[model samples]
Target: MSPYLKLLFYLSGISFAVSFEIDYSNPDVVEYDSNSQIEKTEKVDLRVYYCSFCGGCVYFHTKQLDPTLKKIGSYIDLKNYPYGLTTRYKKHGKIYFDCAHGPAECHGNKLHACAIDILKNTTQSEFYNSCMMNSTWGGEGSSDKDAINCGKLMRIDSKPIIECANSERGDAIMEYYGIETDKVTNPKNKHMPLILLNGKEFNRAKDLMKTICQTLTKPPPECKSYF
Candidate 1:
């Protein structure tokens, strides 16, 4: 080939290589918002306290864990939460621990779509506005839908006292009632929310319901006691 022709071919090859590298490094076809003012300025570390199996919970946890530390501006460090999304005990599958990756992980892309929308520009008030919390027995289907709808409706109502006091799942029943948290103080026991008050004359569930009722202009009628 002639000198000019050879030079043209060489430059074409170089151009192709550069273009390929650029595409490979940044695979996302759509570009994110480029405005620096609205972009997160710094990364902040957040210790997540909820189950990793729930996408909504994980979404909040990730957003709170500012990504700027890695120069990425608000991202999560999966390596940190070893007991992530799938650490439930073998004997008692109802309880789940924590984990970082995999489809089973709480933050799997499927469940967090709505949450992601809220996270982008919605505030805490907005988030709560879209939730619905119910307290009942023998409900069909899963809590995932309830969590989603409750999030959409922004209402949280725990189980009645009777359910809380008598349910076979003691910790779950208490959590639903907002009266007590499972004790994790003992090393032998898995991590669970701490129960603040003893289940005596001071009914934590009733107090929480009262607080909720007071907060809204129109709250639910007097809370029904389980006992």
Candidate 2:
């Protein structure tokens, strides 16, 4: 990994460790002891591997996942990777990329990666992402411009994000996301926006609330029905 990639991993690693995990490996998969074993609070690790321009991915995140986080945000440690099904290669001393949805998607994916790196907080970055995704919800916004507008709306400085997304650092981060996405074998990554809860495949979107509710040793009040 290049220096930038290492830095991105380092940043994410620090945040992950603060969440009360015992064993951490791939960004996509991590295991933790039940909160009972640890005096400090433990969090369920949530990982989502997605591509930015996939309509289904966008809808799931912006429409479904965002709302779900509102209730379980405190109980979860979420990591969102944005290069699903994208490939990269070095050509003529420059790194190039091929994405599932073409160049536009690749650009969007890189933009997402940049946002993650610059913001350094998945939830905060996701808000930025939700903005960009929703801006293009009707297929109307350019990736770069949407990022800036989202940043403005969210009161974030998007200048660095723009520079990183258009630079080699962006390519490096995208590559990092690709490597992380490859570690997802449980659901076999059959599709983008593949969800992993506590290192297991979680396919039931409707049961998301209940699942998280039941997973935690002490379920939250929002999951009252599950009690």
Q: How many pairs of residues in model 1 come into backbone collision?
A: 25
lDDT of 2: 0.69
TM-score of each: 0.22, 0.77
Error of 1 at 209 (Å): 24
Residues 1-227, candidate 2, lDDT per residue (tens digit)? Answer: 65334323533434532121111122222122122233455578888888887777776775566656655566777888898787789999888889988998888888889988887766667767766765432353338777776665566788899889889999999988888887774454568778888888788456677778888888777878888
Residue 135 displacement (Å), model 1: 5.8
Please give the range of 10 consecutive residues that has the lowest summed lDDT in model 2.
Answer: 18-27
Model 1 stretches with alpha carbons more than 4 Å out: 1-43, 52-85, 88-142, 151-227
Q: List the residue pairs that clash in candidate 2.
A: none
